[model samples]
Target: MAEAYPWQEALWQQLAGRTQHAHAYLLHGPQGIGKRALAERLMALLLCQRPKGLEACGECKSCLLLAAGSHPDNYVLEPEDTDKPIKVDQVRDLVSFIVQTAQLGGRKVVLIEPVEAMNINAANALLKSLEEPSGDTVLLLVSHQPSRLLPTIKSRCLQQACPLPGFEQSLAWLGKALPDSDEQERLELLTLAAGSPLAAVSLQAQGVREQRALVVDGVKKLLKQQSSPSQLAEAWSAVPLLLLFDWFCDWSNLVLRYQLTQDEEGLGLADMRKVVQYLAQKSSQGKVLEIQDWILVQRQKVLAKANLNRVLLLESLLVSWAMLTAQR
Candidate 1:
């Protein structure tokens, strides 16, 4: 069974309670939320031979097949590799699958996650399936970034928006998810995850707090001229490039915000509060804006999975960051 999130109770009721299901549903929301899980749960409910009050009966043959990953009528479409675009060929295969009769004489279900991963050709191919529904087939499309999807693709499906759980609700869930972690630690994790509880759990597993501490210390040393950009870059080799870019982008935003508003409360993350304030005081707004723009471009490239020299990228970022305080 897909893990049911407490935040999604109303959403589940709304979706599962529908008298007639849509041919296609586009579930759009921020990453790390339970959009995918909700779709999975819906798929199971649709496929179950005997549903028990808007829920799948785990004892049914259909449920057993699905749990065993041998369900013939259900298909999942995703990128072959992580962060890679779904190829047109894969969409072609899915189209072929769509035209076939269900082996179980039941509904056919298709789940495509991160639907924005489909490129132009692939997305076009998928449009055919969406335009023409076959039998009792249901298509569930999941997208973390719906803005990147083609307008036509968005128009054909019933769009469902999954919102982030409330801070208190997420924190409450996190307490049970991570009983070993204290309240303060969970609070910090939730903050760092931008209020996404699942993301907070993932960050905890990845030791993001430890990595953040190291990066924070490195930045302090860099500002003090105690550590060079190249040395710090090498030291941070173990850290993920995307994560590093995210932190730097966040810091740049915080610095600019502080410079404009002079809001002590806006200096994000306690570990970097002093550093951000100091930089905001010393650094010119123009320089901060310049770095922020550069970070956004680089962050895009990272998201696109461009072939980038990690060390060089980090060095360049640090060099630009260090120059923010040079005018002082």
Candidate 2:
């Protein structure tokens, strides 16, 4: 296996070379922070017939098969379709695969990415396998939102936490990765990604920066009474609802912070400092908190598969935000 990220080295060291390995490991971390990469590296090391220290020997047959994506004992379970939940049948299949003997007479490894995507029934189905191991079996479950997982599921495995890198470290790594990007652009991307270096790089590559700017600008206009909620929603039709809601949630927190402290220090969103300050001054502390609460509730609804009218939801949030400064 190739080396994990620079920040992940210490954690990797702790996980490697244990006398007795757990039947399952839950690797929990924020999205785009290399949790999956770390899990993959560990998986390769576990399946390698001849591992050197914590890494796989690339010359081995097991390594070659894994690299070629044809390893007989390796199983990966994920949602069949994008944005869909993993079904119970999928977990059943994984359970069956786990009971089988390894083709190479070695350990069998099962990888489940974003385990939160598994619905309740699916999670319940996998619980038995997790509780009782059949053979030399290992399960690596990667989750970005571990809170959504069943507590019983979490308790059945040893958990490993992966944290975001420090700001300077993230910026430095991002600088080397995208040499052509200027410091300001890199910082902007980092801010947009909530300080996750890999997420920043991904957002930049996906042109989220441009879309984010449009949303922020539209928000500024809405707050200034220059744009209506419906108009802004229509203008931002291309932007995903979840992304917009998340951005609003972030901004709402900042507005509340400014209202409480009256200081802008350490408040991210460098490019929108002026707008954030303007909204902070004009908006009341209570109103900001109310809107923040509303955002949280709506975000949970969106995640819980609640049926919602997109345009109406967006308009409601925007209108509430625009009225934060209204005189009682």
Candidate 3:
């Protein structure tokens, strides 16, 4: 498969050793943590008729077909807009590919990315194919959140979690790609990114820096218990819900680091240690985990246009969050 992220190399070799011969697998992890890259690489290695296990022999006929995206035995299922979910038709089409005999007379490989997008009907349809994958056919499903997938779908595959590389590793990797990047800025984004290199890069480009300042300042005012909770929520009404989650995680980790290691440098400086620690220690029980679970529920409700009142939603978040912080 693709060159794995640093944290994933060991897992790749493990899979190479124990799972290369399996018929199905689920490579699941946080978004943008390189699961797709690893999946493609694994596919290449498996389809290679003469793999050294060191690497796929890239010049082989199978490799050539894969490179051209014309491999008869290799297929990738995804949720295109026209196909909001991976359809039964898509699953049925696989029968032909699995039965038509491989173009190279080799193994058949199919990958489904974000397998969670498969709606109930589509999921059940794919379940049919999973029931009886043909000889030497390999199925790989890539899901960032397997919780979004049906447990039945997960049961058919051998699941492996792709670990995210921590901040230090992400910084070093992103450094090579951003030679002129500001050290403080890079670390801030790196911490914010939670081990995803692309997320680090995307944050820099997305003006998340200023956005975070707004969020941090807003959260601090709410914690100070100065501004009316409703007013604070009104100000933050437009911030992405994910921003709240990201802030919570990063702030908690930062405060934990300060308490456990006393590393108040760079991004640590961006943190108001006492403020962070207070908020972190508080909402943790009241809202940290609960809000996280709620966010997913809210995301669906909001996205579905299920009568979400932005005012009440944001106000509830701030009020609960502030009340908890007050206990600290």
Candidate 4:
């Protein structure tokens, strides 16, 4: 059985209560908010031989097959490699599967996660299946960044926005998900995860807090002239490039926010609050904005899986960041 999150209870009721299901649904939201799980739950409900009031009957044959990963009526499309674009050939294969009759004589369901992973050609290939529905087939498209999707693709489906759970709700859930961690640690994790509870758990598992501590220490050293850009970049190589960029990007934003609004509360996580405030006071807004722009552009390239020289990239970023306080 799919884990039904408390935050998604109302969403589940609304979706499962529909008298007639849409041929396709576009579930769009921020990452780590359980959008994929919600889609899977819906898929199970649609395929279940006997549904028990907005939920799937776990004892049914269909449920058993799905749980066993042998369901013929369901298909999942995703990139072969993580962070890579879905190839056109994969979409072609999915098109072939969509045309086939369900072996169980029930509804055929297709789930494509992070749909924005499809390149233009692959997305175009998928459009054919979306334009012409076959039998009782239902397509569920999940996108963390729906803005990247084509307008035509967005137009063909019932677009549903999945919102983040409230802070109190997220903390309550996190208490159960991470029983060993205290409230302060969980609070830090949730803040690090940008208020996404699942992301908070994942960050905990990935030791993101440790990685963050290392980076924060490095940043403080860099500002104090105790470390070189090259040294810190190589030392932090094991940390994910995207994660590093995200932190720098966030820090830059916080610095600018504090400089403009002078809001001490806006200085982000406690790990770097002092640094953010110091940089904000030392650096000019123009210089901070410039660095922020550069970070955003490079961040996009990283997100696109560009062939970047990681060490060089990090060194350059640190060089610019170090200069932020040089003018003081």
Candidate 5:
């Protein structure tokens, strides 16, 4: 039984009150905002034989089956591999499931997470199912990038935006989730997660704090010319490529911010304030923007699943940063 976050309470209440739900719902929001949790909770609520308020009755057969991951009418579709495309065949199977009668004789639910991962063919295949879902069915499409979906698909479902919680809300949640973390550490983690509390929790669980420090230290060394790009890239090879690029992109933006404003107010890299200040003083705005643009290009390449040599990519990025240290 998935529980809703504090920020999701209002939405949960609203959804609970609705006796008649749309055939499909598109829960679109930024990544790490708990959309999937909300969707799963809703699925449980819909599937519960004896529902109580917005929650599922634990003793119900449906609830037990769902908990055991054998719910006959509840379907979840995702990419077969991480960061890969969901193919058309998966949607074809979902179509077959949709046509079948509900085993529990209650509402059927289908959940597709990060639906943007579906390629053009898969997206097209899903359009027909999304348009005309059979029986008492609810299709929940959870997307971090809804803009990538076809326009016709968007028009077929009710759009729900799950927004990031405010800083104070996030801080309170983090304090409870990570009680061992001090105030400063909580703030840093929350900032790194871009105000997403769940993402902050995940970062802590993955030991991102230690990895981040190493990456930051490596960047400092690179800027000081103490290490070469190839060496730093090899040292940080164990780190996830996307996460490393995201941090680098953030740092690049901070450098640009400092160059433009000559102040470090609200910078994401608060722990590296001195480094940001130093780079701001030494690097020209033009140079910083060039690096920022390059980072954006690299990020797009990664998102597009371009065939890239990981070491070479990181090496080139580091070399670019090192060169910027010499900018007048």
Candidate 6:
């Protein structure tokens, strides 16, 4: 394995050692969490002519070519465009690579990123290769959700489960890298990022905290009697509602904990959580889940249609909470 993230040590060992079977590997994980990094690492392990003490021998011919992105044997399958799915044509092209000769004349490492992005036809097309893979062909499929993959596809490869790191583990890793940083603030960022160290680091890089704060503060004021959807929409038009949804889910859990334990730290919700719950009780038998379910559905729509007017959609939908609270 190439030098990898700390969490990947055990996974890399299993794939590298000949003590186990050498079949296609499913390196499943969400965006970030170093899925791409791990895929590249596995590619090095398979294609490297020699390995130095469990790490890739970078000086070898295969490693050199692979490093420079000119390796002919290793194929990476991806969607035609960022928003597009892997089409039948692309998957067909992939099958051609698998059966044909390797440019490196050795192991062929094929990596399909977010394999779930493959359309139905493309997924079915890949099935034949998965079922009868040629010798020395290594498959690496990375995904955030395995369930999104076809059952046939899932059955054809070995699954390497990659989960988000724990908050403390992520925090400690960020600490060394983010030395001289504010501890409390960083931990808060780490916690908000779902314990993915990369996420925390990237969030810091992009000033996600300030963005989130702007999102929360913008929505908070809309949770009141006689709140106008138009007014709320106008205020939050520039904010991304999907990002708001992400924060709300986290905030809702905090509220749920507050409701149960009355913990003050959790009690200080950024205001949208209360709005969502307020709407939920009004429409869902005092259950916040109904509101949450609607939000989830809207999220899918938002992802599917990038042109959605987030402010209008969210303001109209979330205004229910204000009405519910006013009724109370």
Please tell me which predicted candidate would have the highest TM-score against the true structure.
Answer: 4
Please identify model 2 stretches exceeding 4 Å from their true place. Answer: 1-3
Off by over 4 Å in 3: 17-20, 49-53, 81-96, 221-239, 248-269, 272-274, 277-312, 319-328
Instruction: Estimate the TM-score for candidate 4.
Output: 0.98
Which pairs, if any, clash in model 2? 1-56
As for lDDT, the candidate ahead, 3 or 5, is: 5
Model 4, span 1-328: residue lDDT tens = 7788888888888999999999999999888889999999999999999999988998899999999999999999989998899999999999999999999999999999989999999999988789777889999999998988999899999999987999999999999999999999999999988899999999999999999999999999999999999999999999999899899999999998998899998898898999999999999989999999999999999887889999999999999999998855
Per-residue CA lDDT of model 6 for 185-255, tens digit only, reads: 77767766667788788778777777777656655666533446677667656556666677655555554
Residue lDDT tens for model 1, 220-315: 999999999999999999999999999999999999999999999999889999999999999999999999999999998887678999999999
Against the true structure, candidate 1 reaches a TM-score of 0.97
- Full-model lDDT, candidate 1: 0.94
> What's each prediction's TM-score?
0.97, 0.96, 0.75, 0.98, 0.94, 0.85
Colliding pairs, model 3: 1-41, 1-42, 2-41
Residue 25 in candidate 3, Cα distance off native in Å? 0.7
Evaluate residue 95 in candidate 5 and report its C-alpha lDDT on the 0 to 100 scale.
90
Cα deviation of 178, candidate 3, in Å: 2.9
Q: Which ten residues in a row have the lowest lDDT in candidate 1?
A: 128-137
Residue 269's C-alpha lDDT in candidate 3? 43
What is the lDDT, from 0 to 100, of the residue 254 in candidate 4? Answer: 94
The full ranking of all candidates by TM-score, starting with the best, is 4, 1, 2, 5, 6, 3
Model 5, 64-171: lDDT tens per residue? 999999999999999999898899999899999998999889989999988888888888988888989899999999998887788988999999998788999999
Query: Candidate 4: misplaced stretches above 4 Å?
Result: none
Would you give me the overall lDDT of model 2? 0.88
